[model samples]
Target: MNFIPFLIICPLTFLAGLVDSIAGGGGLISLPAFLLAGLPPHNALATNKLSSSIGTTASTVRYCKHGYFDKRLTVPSILCALIGSTCGAHLVLLTSDTVVKKLMLVVLPVVAVCVLTDKKEATQVAAFSHRKRMLIVCISAFLIGIYDGFYGPGTGTFLLLALTRLAHMDVRTASGNVKLINLSSNVAALFTFLFSGQVLFAPGLAGAAFCLAGHYIGSGMVMKNGTKIVRPIIIIVLILLFIKVISGN
Candidate 1:
């Protein structure tokens, strides 16, 4: 393995963390960087997960310390998301990426439009009772967890959108909670990749360190600026996902 690529992967991983920490689309950048560095698809994905899990852990801890994670929802969301992702991963073997990709291309634009237009609705919480809120969140987690597991280019963005629009979470709260859940999904995938001998630890560890730094900075930006920043980042990530899916890149 060439040692020179770390110079590139490290910075790119950090950038990915920054974007991902804010609104959830880090893999769109990091995975490409890994492949551009000449890692095979399997190695690139496995390594990317290691690096992202590091960044996400740091971000989630930051949010937890700041009192962003809702305990009532976090525990259930984690469990449901884990189980949902496992199911999605198993089902993926029987499904097709092209079909999913084409469908998302059509669906994402509509989601993006609704999210961009409704400033009030975006921040407003639903009128559900506490138990109902928990139920909705758990169900959303399972379904989106499955989606993340089956095809994950925009897992964070989708989670943010769902929670904000349906679960009545504010942008900042949604951003933070989604990070926690996304990390759960990443962990699920990483462990499998780890056992399969796919993760490239030397470079992945280096990327992880920088990714944590980026997550710190990005999460801070969201805290300070709130929806002003998170919304655009979410939109940008979605657009990037659209291109990525359509172009087959």
Candidate 2:
């Protein structure tokens, strides 16, 4: 119940939620904040999941309320994400962090270029058959869900990109779908940490309040501005991820 950790975590969590709500990669900020505040690594990761899960729920509801989510893809995507994330979590136990970090170093730049070079407008949906799109979406969701569970720095950004570029969804709809998928993964992880007693509820709850505020505002901005807001934030998140990987932090 230290005020110091609360002070450090809450503000950054707000910032993290804001960035995450818009373009993903909030953990690049929030997780580090928890560590900086002196939480042990396990507790920091656990508490981060707690706060982020709550904040993500708010964003997901907001996106769905705005009719940005695709009902047809919802159940399948969530199921795939759940299964993938569970597998990913287990995979992490067998994998080395160094391997993941090295892979990200190569992957992040390519992702950034794709986001930058993407000329598609927020409202422009790509042409793809419904069945084909469903296949693409579900597969992407499952694969990215595993990445979320295994490495998890920019899962939302990756999902957003996949939905937009691969599944041919518009930015608004893709963003919403990303939120839903991320929420499932986050909640799954949160429960694991919660059951294991790694979550620090006092700070986690406090951070959640701030995170909720951030998500509300950020998602509102995306709803208003669409791709103009999202693209830049995504680039920024990519840059942050790249730095984190290279620096090995």
Best by lDDT: 2
- Can you list the residue pairs that collide in candidate 1? 125-168
Candidate 1 residue runs with Cα over 4 Å from true position: 21-24, 90-121, 217-249
Tens digit of per-residue lDDT, candidate 2, span 14-65: 8777866665556666766666576755666678778878877877887899
Error of 1 at 16 (Å): 1.2
Error of 2 at 14 (Å): 1.7
lDDT of 1 by residue, 24-110 (tens): 556666765665565655676668778877877877787888988677788989998888876665565344545644655665566
For each candidate, the alpha-carbon lDDT, in order, equals: 0.70, 0.73
Candidate RMSDs in order: 4.8, 4.5
Q: Against the true structure, what is each candidate's TM-score?
A: 0.73, 0.75
Candidate 1 yields a Cα-based lDDT of 0.70
Q: Which runs of model 2 end up more than 4 angstroms from their true locations?
A: 21-24, 93-124, 217-249
Span of ten consecutive residues with least summed lDDT in model 1: 112-121
